[model samples]
Each structure stands twice: as structure tokens, then as C-alpha cells.
Target: MVRIAYDPTPYHFNHGVLELPDIVARLGYEYMQLTPHPEFGPFHRMPKADDELVAALKKRAADAGVKIVALQPVQRISWPEEPQREAAVRNFKRVIEITAQLGVDTINTEFSGRPERSEDSEAGFYRSMEELIPVAEKEGVRINIDPHPDDFVEDGLEAWRVIRGLNSKQVGFVYVGSHSFHMGNQAATLLPQVGDRLGAVFAADTYDHHRSNGLRYITNPPGNSVRVHQHQEIGNGDVDWNELFDTLGKIGYLDREDAVIVSNVFGENEDAEGSALRQLDKIRELISGAAR
Candidate 1:
């Protein structure tokens, strides 16, 4: 059976960990992919949370019957300089430890560009991977690097190359269709290879060319730009879902099972919760139809 998962980034402002499972369960998604933005707010970070607290959170979700597909930790390990870079690495390790305690195997993150020379940036990337890879292995977790348009590694090809260079099975790609569409309309050609390094998939929409940088840019209020133009819902954009879904299926995505997809619905702070629910409902319908 295909497992459907939701990324909580869309409605994160309106909800918290405590209320997430219920909302997710209510929407009919089997798994919930938590986008743990450390700086987002107090409720989402849980930095000082111990095993007992972590277990409680997991128990709450389980009690609600919403499994954790993965934890998407953004900017958890992205830094421009060495000192800040080290700090980012430490934060990332903490997140890995949390995932380990929570019984989650996938930790999704990104590598922001280094403002150094090209060769220096390449060197820093490998160095960063080497630094972070062992923590993932030690924790028995897969490090998912989802490509963002503004990041150093934004497209499928570069991500593949980085993973190959790292040469560890612990690293994989979280194929974000919006970024793929904006960076290059290559998800179709990339899907086959995507399966090979597949860690997760974030189902989102974007325009033909604007700010599809994987960072949702809410030109509206709440001032979040991780992804561009949070739009109202899926299938309301120019992204070719049919072909993308078909290609994903061919690559063994299996509708909602092979990967976890999250919807990035843009809206004002007051309308956030409704937008997320709306996106979730629409996606459930879309995936259901696609599966058929």
C-alpha cells in the first residue's frame, strides 16, 4: 500500500506538535512529515527536549495514528563561514539525535551556498558532508538533502553529484518539484535517477519562472520565503503533475507510499490553518485519483 505523508511547513504557524497529529489524521494522511524549523518558533524547536519528551511527542502522534514519515530540518546545517558552519553542524547533530530517539530514520536538510571561491565552496561541501555523514550513520538515519533554488546544490544533477562524491548510502535526495521546475524542467529525466538516491519527496507547486527557488517566498504577510508564492493549492499551478506523478510511479514512487509529499499553501497568518487543510484535502484527492 502507498503511504501518504504531509509536510507541516504549510500550516506550521497555525498549529504545533501537540495539535499536528490530530489535524493530519483528520485529513486522512497516513504519515506526517514534520518540517522542524528551529527558528520558526518555540513549539517546533524543542531544543531542550529529552528522551521522555521526545517519546511523549511520538506517542501522541501514534495515539492519533499519524506515523512520522520523516523530519524536514531546514537551515539546520547551512552556514557560510567556519565558526557559523560548525554551529550549524552541531545543530544538525542534535536534530539527528532527536530523530534517533523518536524512531525516525530520515532527516531532511539543505546546503546553503558558501560565499567563498568556487573551489573553496566545493571543498567546504565535501568537508561538511564528511562531518555530518558519521552522525547519520551512527544514528542509523538517512540524511535527505532537498534541493533549494538559492542553495549551493539546488538541482537534481548537482545533488546527485554531491551524493555520489560523498559515496555514502546515508545521503539521498528529497525531490521538490517546484525547485526542479524552476531550476530546470528535468524531474522527468531526473526521476529515474531520483529513485536511486530517493530519500523523500516534497509535493509543491510553482510558477513557470518566478521565485521557484525551493524557498517558499510568501510575497504576502507572515514573511516566510522558503518556497515562492505559497499559492492556494496543488493542481492550481503550471507544474505538470500527471507527468511528474507518472514518472515518479515509473521510478517506484508508488503514489503516496514510496515517498512523503508536503503541500506549501501560501496564505496570511490568520488564514494559514485553513489553507493547509485545503491543500491537504486537495492533495489527498489528487493522489487518490492518480493511484486509480
Candidate 2:
């Protein structure tokens, strides 16, 4: 009962494209995670997009029968300078508002960053959440902070700090298995701690040796010497996805509302797309087999 989704970034898809909804639908994903155009810094802080454009996008998604699950931010905002940080928070607030209007309930961002070793890194997380949580509560959308590889709070333990620091139901975490695999944490043990507070999980392939080495590629895939975190299609990486899915199931995530496990496919070539879709199909079949 685990639902699957695609990040749609590397595939040259975004909100601006009028064809995105149809593309997502045709890809057979149940949820679409929207990202801000790179030029706009991922959150698209232009206040409101053209109403006509919004209407058209909404209509297309409706026609395609896909749900827009969460609004994702551009990566830069995660570890911005102090001066730029406030504006990033403001922009994130606006993104949540936009999602709320669209009837979506989650705002996903790279805001869970680790600042340069300072007194504020720990306090800053709480301070930032205090400002945003009220806005999220008001807008009726939850905030999901993604734990990126190099960012502050990149691993599950650090992510737990922010999640526990905020102590607000409105704030949650997005656990990317690649992130966990990169950190070499036991996914089964870490997942239950986050549980439903896990707004979403990015299920992609990661090479254990590569992820362990901070994503550096000393060797290439199939080369027998590569150890970098190459974002491979699912079923091709070192992670035991069946065990990962079982862990998710044990946490009562099966068929839960907004339970989205998306694949953040790195390469955008046609081969990558085929590989991604194939991975999803395999995952769907695996989950079904597990249920039976």
C-alpha cells in the first residue's frame, strides 16, 4: 500500500510547464511534488503566479487525476547567509500559502540545514520553526524539511533534533532513504522514530560505499571500482528496498493519507526515465506481493 511518486525535477518538469500534470499522470505516479523554477529559487516567491496559468495547471492536473502533494524549495535556501535566511523563510511561508490554496497540505524545503559551527545552529532551527509553524498552522499546511546529504541536519539523528526541537505537529521531516543510506544508519531503526511525522520519503538508489564517502565518485557504476553516491534507479543500488518497505509498513504507513514515497531520479536522460519507471513498477509489485 505504499504510494509512489517522482520528483519531476531532473525530468525537466515543473509547475510552469503546462504539460506537467499530464506527464506525471502518464508516468503512473499518484502524487506530484512541485518545485519552484530554478530561476525563482524553487519556492517561486513571486507572490501569485498568473491566475490563468494557475487555473490551467490545476485543470490539467485534475484532468490527469493526480494530486499535487507538496511544494518543494530550491536547494540554496537550506544553508544561506544570516541576511538571506530570513528572506528564505519568508519565501517558504509564501510557498505554504500557495499550497494551501491549491488544497495541498505540505510544504517541503531544504530549510533543514546545518549552519557553520556556531552557537546558533542548534537554536537557529528552533527559532526558524517558531516563525514558520504559526504560518503553517494558519494556512492549514504542514511543513516538511528534507534532510539533504551535506546540509546541516542531513542525517536522521540531526533531523530528529529539529523535529523534536520544534515540538509542533505542523512541522515534520522528509526522510530520503538515500540520505540514510549515505549516512550508513539502519533505516529500519530510524524510520519508526520519524513515523507519520515523515511527510514523505524519497526512495532512490544509492551506493553504500559512495554515500559513505560523501557522494564522491572514485569509481563509476558497473565499473567495479566506483564508490560515490551515484543516484541509481531503484533495485540497482545497495539498499535492500524490501526491508526498507517492510520497515515503513511496520510503522503503519500502509495506505495512509498523503503517504508518498517518491524517487528523486538524478539523471534526466530517456534511459534514466525508463529506469525510474521500471523501478517504480518493481516497487509496486513488491509491495503488492508483500501484502498478499
Candidate 3:
């Protein structure tokens, strides 16, 4: 059944790997999605988590009564150059090995490629997948790709197309709630469209710019200025919670172990643990109401 998972990204910036599981357990969450931290080595490049480190982290999670159900490694899997693409493939293989060791069957990430070079990036992405899909199948790990604002394939429908092109059950789509506007402001439409291929949901609320023309935020040039959103708690933003859950239910996504719903809110000066607990309660309420 739909276990609510906490993503330790806000904590990763302030805490180390060994110290995170206890915090998560204290917040009353048994499942988590582990994010990359410097202490654990860069997930994009050659990750340095050896056997010893992996075992230690696994033990820590067990001691705290937490199950790491998913691992998120933020890497540019669609780099245009052959050498860089090969390196990304190697790094992803290492991540899959670690996922197996931690007893996690899923890895969630973005189809990160440069927006300026979409065609070349997509070619590189398929090439990398050609090499990595076999490793994922061998390790019994499933990869869930999401559409990020700056990624080459940012549209929800297009992301689904990429997953379909892969044509492997081991690969699926993750819908990030905060990216609804960037993905075409049609979460209600897209959720049902993804249907069974929807592997996970990064649950958070986001403002709908269509109603409010106010500038959300600004970033320096050469960076992703088109992206403007926040990962806020439910009800703080414009995401229709009831509609989202209703769509999920319509697609038969409720009460399933494999259909994960993760609370992943990121911001500065926010109480990470407190916010996580609040988000969990909100999600549980939504699920309870949906069941009725």
C-alpha cells in the first residue's frame, strides 16, 4: 500500500548520511528516498560509495526502522559528448549496484540534457540507456525518469514518449507535482495519461502562474530563468490535492507498494523534519478521503 516516503534533500544539506535515518524515524516515516550528498560522493560522476560504506548506511537505516525504498541520483544522463555519456552510464551502474545493496528496487532521476541541444542530447540519452538498461535489468532495479524545467525533454507527454520508446518495464515515469506548470499545467490530464507507467509521485504544491501573473522568481542569465516554482506544503500553493488524488485513483494508483508517493519539499530556512511530518499528515488525509 501507498507508503508515504520522505526525501532527505533538505536534511542532506545540513546533516550527514549516518545522521539522517534517525531524524527520519523520529518524524514517524518508515520509508525514504535518499538524495546524493558530498559525504556519499557525487552521484553524477563516478560515485565513490564502496561496499563498506553501503553496508554501513544500510545498517543505519535498519537500526532506525527505516526502509530506503528509492534512491535519487541527479545526473545529466543526456550529455551530448560520447565520453561524458559513457561516464554517466558508468555512474548510473554504480548507483544501481548501491540500490540493490540497500534493498531499494527503484532509482528516480531527471532526463537531464541541455535544452539548447535537444536533438543531440536525446540521441545521447538513448545511447546511454542502451548501455545502462541491461545493467538495470540485471540488477533488478527500475529507473523512474521525471521531466525537469531545464531538461531537454521537459514536457510530460514527451517524457512519456521517451519512456515508451525505451519499451522496458524496468523504466517508468515520475510526476513531480511542483513541475505541473512547467510540464504544461495539465497534471490532471497528464496523471491519467501516464497511467500504469507512472512509477512514483514527488508530492508537493506549486503556484499556478496562469492565475497570478506576478513574477515568481528570478535567476541569473545562462541559468534556467524559465523555471519559477516552489516546493511548498500542500494548501500553501495552487496544486489541487483532491483532483490529483482523484486522478491517481482513476488510474488505479492507490494502495500499492510499488506506487510510491514521496514528500519532497525543498527551501531555505524551513524546518525540514517538521515540514515532513506535516506533509505526511496531509497526504494520509488525502488517501483516507480518497478511500471513502
* Cα lDDT tens digits for candidate 2, 114-187: 53532355555556666778888988998777766555555676666667677788878777766655455667
Write down the lDDT of every candidate, Cα atoms only: 0.66, 0.66, 0.84
Question: How would the candidate models be sorted by lDDT, starting from the highest?
Answer: 3, 2, 1
Q: Estimate, for each residue in 79-151, the C-alpha lDDT of model 3 and write its tens digit.
A: 8777777778888888989999888899999888888888999999898898889998999999999988888
Task: Give the clash total for candidate 2.
Answer: 5
TM-score of 3: 0.94
Instruction: List, in order, the clash count of every candidate structure.
Output: 13, 5, 0
Mind giving the per-residue lDDT tens digits that candidate 1 earns over 1-292? 3555766665565566667788778766768877653332232233555677678778989999988867766542445467656666666777788888888888776666542343455566677778888988999999878666656656578667776777788898777766655457787787687565776766667666544463333454555434443343566567777777667667666644446666655443365556566766766666665623
- TM-scores, one per candidate: 0.81, 0.84, 0.94
In model 2, pairs of residues that clash are: 36-42, 114-152, 210-227, 210-228, 219-226
**In terms of TM-score, how similar is model 2 to the real structure?**
0.84
Weakest 10 consecutive residues, lDDT, candidate 1? Answer: 37-46
Candidate 1 vs. true structure, TM-score: 0.81
